[model samples]
Target: MHENIDPAICPVCGGDNGCALLAGQPIEQCWCMRTRIPKEVLSAIPAERRGKACVCQACAAGSAPARPD
Candidate 1:
């Protein structure tokens, strides 16, 4: 994770990431625990933001428009 990134925001689209851990919940309780983010989707995160914040469900599921490359 990037040192200055907000874990609660989606690195891809700047939206809520819905991360349970960031919300004071357990990792196992996060939506990501049950969802398998695709390689393409994961790769969409900017290099600087990669591993910093989670991608929101909309972006991960291909519903949200990705940031312009």
Candidate 2:
């Protein structure tokens, strides 16, 4: 799956200064290869935009794990 994203823009935060994990990359080569993103944060993304988008480190880091209610 290839995410036709702006090379350096974050969809959630709208920041355009760094690289997001492009869609069609090998899992091992993807930018998200190292850090672990929270499932809650991933799910919060709108359905139509999931997998087709990539979040920046700042944004990912900002999404602290959700607490149980």
Candidate 3:
């Protein structure tokens, strides 16, 4: 596993993943539980980060990469 992996962050874009489960909410309450994260989008995340953190909605929806900030 990658060091310092934060489940609250997006593994792909390094942004806030907004995972309800990470926020102490039920797993069923997480948006990811209801949404279908595309295979291509999931493939974008680095191997070290995959499954370590949640991908953000934008990344999961294939609408974002690294955001300008």
Best of the candidates, TM-score: 1
List the candidate 1 regions with Cα displacement exceeding 4 Å: 1-3
The Cα local distance difference test for each model comes to 0.86, 0.57, 0.83
> Model 3, 1-69: lDDT tens per residue?
338878888888888999898789999999989999888888888888777888999998888766343
Top candidate on lDDT is: 1
Report how far off residue 49 is in candidate 3 (Å).
0.5
Q: Which ten residues in a row have the lowest lDDT in candidate 1?
A: 1-10
* Each prediction's TM-score versus the true structure: 0.87, 0.53, 0.85
Pairs with steric clashes in candidate 2:
none
Clashes of each: 0, 0, 0
Q: Pick the winner on TM-score between candidates 1 and 3.
A: 1
